[model samples]
Target: MASESSPSDPAAWLALLDWRRQISALYARVRELRDSDPPAAHALWQAERNRLFRAHSQSPLLPEARADFVSLPCWPYDPALAFSAPVEFLPLERLDIPSSTGQAMPLVRFGRVELPVGTLDVYWIDVYGGGVFLPFRDAGSGHESYGGGRYLLDTAKSADLGSAPGGALVLDFNFAFHPSCFYDPRWSCPLAPPRNVLDVAVRAGERAS
Candidate 1:
């Protein structure tokens, strides 16, 4: 763990703040352009992510990995894999999910979303300034994607893709990404729970490199 006097501590916090700001801005543009040109919006998203991974101070890649980084191993953008799914509200049930930091995060199961392939529980951080959280593991996990899983919406850090006119959450699998913990264990991230694991292979997101 980094100490308060460690030079990298402050820089890491500031870099993470900047990273969140950039991510929110990127998603804002995605919401605007996704309707008119899905492919172009996807391209913009991928290019910006590549830039962040390669150049951003808050990147999860190690020094050696960043030195030779080119692009994330991702499946091609497929429109069919994207959807605006309606939320099915459930009786609020609370659970604590273990994190990579060895601490548990309090989460409330507020709803569930049914995709064409399977269903996923939608959670809300049961803490101050709550934000929606949705993480899932597919059949490809441990082989094609991270063994723990990937995140679709972690609004606490401003990783949101926006909502539809009918109030459905815009879930674009092409934009799905591995958590920071996937690359570096220094970061604390919540892993997907048992109910959120899907039986189908979701082949349109970031893959193991």
Candidate 2:
């Protein structure tokens, strides 16, 4: 079940609504621009993400950290990291995922995709309404990106980047991003499991400076 904000905190409710709208807009723009201009789309997406993290009222950053925020350090767009992979659905199985906050969320393993990096299992979040969830960690995790991992697709919160024709999902590493917990300890985000960890160094996504 989803948590609810206090009825007395109207500001909190408004902030949550604003965040949902912003995320939806970002994903929609990505879907529109990726086909024609992938590089441009990536650049714009990064800029918008920076703006949200730095300027938005409902940013995930801790209150004390926002003042010094400039932009998230990210690697340049690399076309080589983008690929269209065929999804192989696994027999439906639910896995209980432990969170940073000690709560467990159930995610159902629905499919797998083989990419240049490796084969990765795709999970469907087991909530009121289901959504795809893809998180990964690479060799560059501790040094380049967040130590835990980064998110490639978390459609539950509108981070989808769309798919290609012929039933292949567009797995773009250029769009891989850090979870909210990277900035604020209050947020409990799901990390990439052992199966999702790639042996290769994915040096094309968002990194820490």
Candidate 3:
């Protein structure tokens, strides 16, 4: 953990800034590949993600876990889980929700997507440089996957899966992944709210090992 004085230290601040830049670049590359070839893109994403978990300075895994870390267990890419749902724009309604960090972040309900399995509300974070946030929980929770939920798209942190024609957003459940908090308790992440919870078992994403 960084000390209290680390934030004020020039070297530490620069290092953190560099880390953010690297992560942004990594996500950008993933988006580019996803637009071209989704399967290949996902494969690359998994590989790069594993690399980050093993070698990145800001890996979420504890030191002891990192030594034995290989790759995150994920279900095979399933095309059935992919969808290009139309976005139903919602009224400008904002809600303040508590985060794992114990801070309440304001989020605006921007749209709703109706998938074959169910419907999910989309939210836009009400903050500077805000972006789309989509978290979902399924029956697999507490067993195969994280008990809290998995994030599908959090564009603010650059986990975009791409979009379809007519402004429909592409949501590929096979790309769903666990938040950092899943690996490290010290990290705090938002879980799937009531509206985002799905009764169906979405067995095509990252799972607990």
Candidate 4:
């Protein structure tokens, strides 16, 4: 079963709602500017994300860390690392991926996207209100990025970039971000499985701080 915030902490739930709203709004603007002005879009994303992490009530940063938080460390945006790829549908297979908080996430492997870097499995969250969930690990993992992985798209939380004219998903490494668990262990986050590990070092997104 999915977890819910404690009823006693209604303020916490409200903050969470605010955080999701801000994220959705930010991505909507990003999708509008990404095709025409990628650099500007990238700057907007980083600036807004830093703002949230530093002061937003739902920020994943620990209380002590937030006090000293300056900005999230990110690599310079590389236009070449972005692509629009078609999803190759596969026979759905149920899988339970282990999480940082030790909760297993039930997902359905439904498709794959072939990119210049490598192919990555695309999954559906499988539970009610299922959404696209694409997490990946690259050569830079554990060195340049988080050890577990980074998420490219987690539509459940509205982290989607608009699709291309052909309906291909816009996979932009520049917007890739580490999961909340990377900042605080209290968050439960599903990681990339072996099939989603890329051989190339996708040096174009949020980096290890």
TM for every model, in the order presented, reads 0.93, 0.94, 0.89, 0.96
TM accuracy, model 4: 0.96
lDDT of 4 by residue, 1-209 (tens): 12433646768888888999999999999999998999999999999999999999888889899988889998898989989999999999999998877788999999999999999999999888889999999999998999899999999988999899989999999999999988887778888898999999999889996
lDDT, model 3, position 40? 81
Alpha-carbon RMSD, each predicted model: 2.7, 2.1, 3.0, 1.7
Q: Candidate 4 clashing pairs?
A: none
Query: Top lDDT: which candidate number?
Result: 4
TM-score top scorer = 4
Q: List the lowest-lDDT window of 10 residues for candidate 2.
A: 1-10
Model 3: per-residue lDDT, tens digit, 9-62? 567667666666776787788778877787887788788788888887667778
Q: Write the residue-wise lDDT of candidate 2 on 35-112 in tens digits.
A: 999999999899999899998877888888889988888899999999888789779988987665667778999999
**Model 3 TM-score (2 dp):** 0.89
Report the candidate with higher lDDT, 2 versus 3: 2
What is the C-alpha local distance difference test score of candidate 3? 0.80
Q: Pick out the ten consecutive residues of candidate 1 with the lowest summed lDDT.
A: 1-10
- The better-scoring model by TM-score among 1 and 4 is 4
TM-score of 2: 0.94
CA lDDT of 110 in candidate 1? 93
Clashing pairs in 2: none
